[model samples]
Target: MNESNLGRREVLDEVELKKLNNIRQKKLNQMDSFEELSYEQIMKMANMHNEILNNIHMSRGDVYLYSENEKLELVEDLYNTYMSDFRDITLKQVVDFSKNVAGVEKSQDLLIYDWEKMYIDQANQILFDSSDIGDLNMSLDKLVGDVKSDNRKMFKTPILLYIETLKESSFYWASVEEGGSGLGFSLLKKRSPYFMSNKKGKKNWKNVAIADAQGMTTGMLGVAAYGAWGVMFGPAGFALTGGAFVWVAVESAMASALFG
Candidate 1:
């Protein structure tokens, strides 16, 4: 071959070598992405597993086993248990749970408030108007009275609200059960696919908030007001009633001032 041909061959060889190296590097990176956990990460995972097992045992009246061997075995068992029931837990629950575990508070509340504002702005879309409002209001009032009479009632008494809370707790516990060492990627992966997509997550939360707020504003408001009324008239009825009236009046005035 001529010198020129040899030079060209050399250049082509160099290019091919560089391309091969790039391909190998890409493969190595992909492998590393799925690599086994580091010692420190493993230890953290073990600790979390132990904590979850301990909590579960405590709640179930079972003896707390602290031995490293026993804890690891228990964690593995829990992981298996969760995997078995994975289908039972909905994607929506996973998303809600993921948000809660991330310390996103009043997530539902913000959505509800926004939805309420939306409804007020578009009054034509109002499903139940002032006519059926009385019955709805009365029912809510009774509910509020029942809850107030039993102070043990939680703020998340509504079915949907309670489900949302459950979803949050489930996601949190599921992450701990899994070999995740407080890593966002693992937790996010375990979350609902709907939640993983930002668009769907926002939309789902907004819809839930809108529905919840509608019920609360119409039916729930009556219950809350009735509860407040009961409290006002409980024992120190005169002072409480006067204070309650003033408070309601002030709230109405402020709301009118801000939005009306």
Candidate 2:
């Protein structure tokens, strides 16, 4: 575990962690039906333009006409639909990279199961592999798709996607590095190997403690970035750090992906 100073950032503590999860769940429960989703809330949820989304659904009032299960289905349908926004870091953008990206053509099980470790030995048993940094970057960008089309387009709420899902699914399981480009969140299953083992009672808890602390920073920054820190954390959640969780999540990949 001594792999070059694991981390040094602060993260949410136990009480704050519980709060983050609870608030996130509440957001989901409140969405038991999309009937309640407001124009503003939708705006907050999606970073991309919704002109296409708006055309498909004439009005918000029309959304509630569907039955309860239909509401969830509606959300899923929207979740699955691609708005074709140009900023989308989609598969089509890097189709050419398929010839060069490592593991780009491998089966899904193999990709996720291997902890998404990049092929370090791409030399082909040949000397001087000449791949550049751009090659590595392209390989990573398209890695998150649940399917080919959805690879780079599975954009969803940062509130629900990153901090919301990971805290529960990972069970505070520490990650020395992020698993992948956060392809998509699994509503029905916990991600494998991401939560692979428990490190309870490990002899050296320094790294664990450091990881947890940095996580708190992420969570705190998350709510703030979600623009709900004031509402969810309230005066007390703010006081915990004498205005806790107010720090910007500018660096949160999950938050920034959906937010910025």
Candidate 3:
């Protein structure tokens, strides 16, 4: 393309980006009026997400093995009984358990978070990077094998977005469970293929957290929104999860639990 053509393409890209951003912002605004959640509510939100997972048959176990206030005597028995369950998820106990079970190193204690990110990043690279098989090409099974052989998370963007969608769906499911509002699982269940490509439908979120991060899907923009927080007040948007994919549930517009 000529320099003039290149300049035009860049302008087009910028315009497209702005349009996507506006759609995302509108969806995020829905949760702005919600109040902050309490500690017990946080626990319930997390547990409810796990319960949703159980119903879906994605995983075998259920959550909520430990309560918010409890004296846990650390012992072989404790480890044997609850290690499989991530039972120490309430408040300070979560940190303490991570430190104990994951070992003494500071990074080691945050291994679960690190591991989750590592997988997501790798998936994004593999699906979106354009260097690998997905030049809109195929050969994912081969690339997956290479991750163990060469040891890398490689893929293209759309596929990575897909991995993100599956990861975020649980939290959205929990939001409706918490009485936040919107369509919840009914909405989320139908949108999985859309985020992978406009041909399939639209965009959506890949994460959810209450703190300084973001997830959830945007049906309008067709691109994933992450790395920012969209707060959900009251019993909605589980706080312990660490980010917010705040609102968004579809294509014409992203729906979510209306706060305030």
Q: Give the TM-scores of the predictions, in the order they appear.
A: 0.18, 0.24, 0.23
For residues 67-186, could you state the per-residue lDDT of candidate 1 as single tens digits? 434433433343344434444433333222222222212223222234333323333122122123233334434433443354332332222222222222222222233322222223
Candidate 3 has its poorest 10 consecutive residues by lDDT at 1-10
Put the candidates in lDDT order, highest first: 1, 3, 2
Model 1, residue 56: distance off in Å is 1.1
The per-model lDDT (C-alpha) reads: 0.29, 0.26, 0.28
What tens digits encode model 2's per-residue C-alpha lDDT throughout 216-237?
2334323332222323233232
Error of 2 at 181 (Å): 21
What TM-score number comes out for model 1? 0.18
* lDDT of candidate 2 at residue 38, scale 0 to 100: 32
* lDDT per residue (tens digit) for residues 1-260 in model 3: 01111000111234544453455456555544323234244334334333333342232221122222211221222233333344433323322322221121111111123443454345444333323122312433344333335423321222222243433332343234332222343444444545434622112222222110111211101222211122221133322222121112110011012100
Off by over 4 Å in 2: 1-10, 32-132, 147-260
How badly does each model clash, as a count of residue pairs? Answer: 3, 12, 23
Q: Cα lDDT of model 1 overall?
A: 0.29
